[model samples]
Target: MDRTARILQDLYDSEINFTIATFWHAGFQIKLGLGDEVNGFDATGTADNLVDAVEWLRVQAIKKYPESVFATNYRR
Candidate 1:
């Protein structure tokens, strides 16, 4: 697979949403998210919005990583 696909797959495996910025010849940025259940990112970029997806992911992550620190940051 390519770099973008690999990165996306990794995010999916981790069950975390991500904000990725892609650059073009002029270095443009495009952010994308992977998870539907977790507000993996604080930015406005979202891949999909399944009902109760964010809540479900939050519960799962809380159970899986009790001591982990996870939050969404929307500052650019």
Candidate 2:
């Protein structure tokens, strides 16, 4: 599967409630929901809080995955 899909799968597998905001025609980004915070890396390449990790993924989507659509305010 693609990176985004893989990441989403991983997140779900970890029992975390991941919220995905899709940017059609581009790539999609995922954010971890409340109480789903696990002290580990997520599918979005995060190694801590899902918020931080998803933000990192958004950055990566913009920089690395140019064609990828992502969410805004990855920092917070």
> TM-score for every candidate vs. truth?
0.29, 0.33
After superposition, the stretches of candidate 2 with alpha carbons farther than 4 Å from their true spots are 21-30, 34-76
For candidate 1, write residues 22-68 as lDDT tens digits.
33443323233343335443333322333233333444444444444
Task: Give all candidates' CA lDDT scores.
Answer: 0.39, 0.45
Candidate 2, pairs of clashing residues: 27-68, 27-69
Per-residue lDDT of model 2, residues 1-76, tens digit only: 8655665564455444555555555455554432434653234432344445555544544443333323222222
Q: Which 10 consecutive residues of model 2 have the lowest summed lDDT?
A: 67-76
Number of backbone-clashing residue pairs for each candidate, in the order shown: 2, 2
True-structure RMSD, every candidate: 12.0, 12.6
> What are the runs in model 1 whose C-alpha is more than 4 Å off?
18-41, 45-76
